[model samples]
Target: MSKAYNETVALSQSGALAALRAAVEKAQEMGVPQCIFIVDPSGETIASLRMDGAKYLSMHTARAKARTAASIRNATGSMTPEFAVAAGIASNGGVTNLPGGLPIRFGGKLAGAIGVGSGTGDQDIEVGRAALAAIEADPI
Candidate 1:
């Protein structure tokens, strides 16, 4: 029988953490406090933080964002709004279905995800993207 050999995998959680810090700092500098979340490949929370001015609602949004990214393995925006609406994605019991959730990919493999909330959707996404970029994790 032929065997399927697997290559060793590597990921820089440190990179992801660094990215989170940088992104949070950037948000702070912009005077936009936010809730940030990071998750592992399996969608387990790795780290999370809420800035002083972040909204309480963002706590749930942040978790939802991370879950959406990990479950779909794509950026939250990847799902067209039309599809999201049709599928009730924005409704209760559906995915977060917002723009602030982004999947983390490394070496063509899903590495993890990041989510941010407590601002405009665009702003949340920007901050999350900054962190993903810092970690060198490809955004899906």
Candidate 2:
């Protein structure tokens, strides 16, 4: 038998927008082009943005990073790079399963996630961090 699921609070569209704007602005301040993604608790994308100069290929990787963060509720970097590689996810091709992606949590509940790419992994993480800080949130 299949089980039914009840829904309650979810990641607000406005929240995602605010979070994304903060992140993009941070990246721009650092002069680091980037692709940003915001995904809901279910790992579904809610918002996304790609700054000019950010590689086109980085878009999908940005989404993957957001997916990983939302699903795992942890910063992608918290998981060792080796782990990501073993799972066939890394900077290889269009995959950036690195430290720059992070989850968005509120009131101890999963809200969504944000991922940034197109720059070095460290730069990407910085952008993600700035966004979370703006909202007083964390990656998980």
Candidate 3:
């Protein structure tokens, strides 16, 4: 039998919150507060947290990173300099090449993405990874 619609896996609110909490915990462990954002496969926000002392402006980048990862089904920061610039401009800053974004997959299905900011790119990635681990999702 063939169906026109395919079953879709989505990120639950609880999963999103768990990821956010785990990301915050990791940020605390690293002594760097951060803005963490989680988005669904369609780039809809699920949960987010801006820890105390985290850069408020960085929240925007975090959102962009999350949306970009979910939209592209790939981790951020892989884009080259030229593509990064072009994509950022083309998307009007909706997408970014920042290193903090990671796609989340569950049961071999794309679930969503997470983005961490207000720290060094490596640190951000570390926090994002912690979030992914918390949800038992496949690492990006």
Q: Top model by TM-score, which number?
A: 3
| True-vs-predicted CA distance for residue 28, candidate 2, Å | 1.1
Predicted candidate 3 versus true structure: per-residue lDDT over 10-75, tens digit per residue: 888888888988999999999999999999888899898899999999999999999999887889
Per-residue lDDT for 18-116 in model 2, tens only? 888899899889998899999887778899999999999889888888888777667886656677676543434333456677878776667888888
Each prediction's whole-model lDDT (CA):
0.77, 0.79, 0.90
Report clash pairs, candidate 2.
77-99
C-alpha root-mean-square deviation, candidate 1: 4.0
What are the per-residue Cα lDDT tens digits for candidate 1 across 1-140? 63322221344667667978977987987789999988876668888899898998897888778877877777886677777776454456346677798887776677777889998999998898788777776654
Model 2 error, position 65 (Å): 0.7
**lDDT-sorted candidate list, best first:** 3, 2, 1
Candidate 2 error regions (>4 Å): 1-9, 80-82, 89-96
User: Could you tell which candidate, 1 or 2, scores higher by TM-score?
Assistant: 2
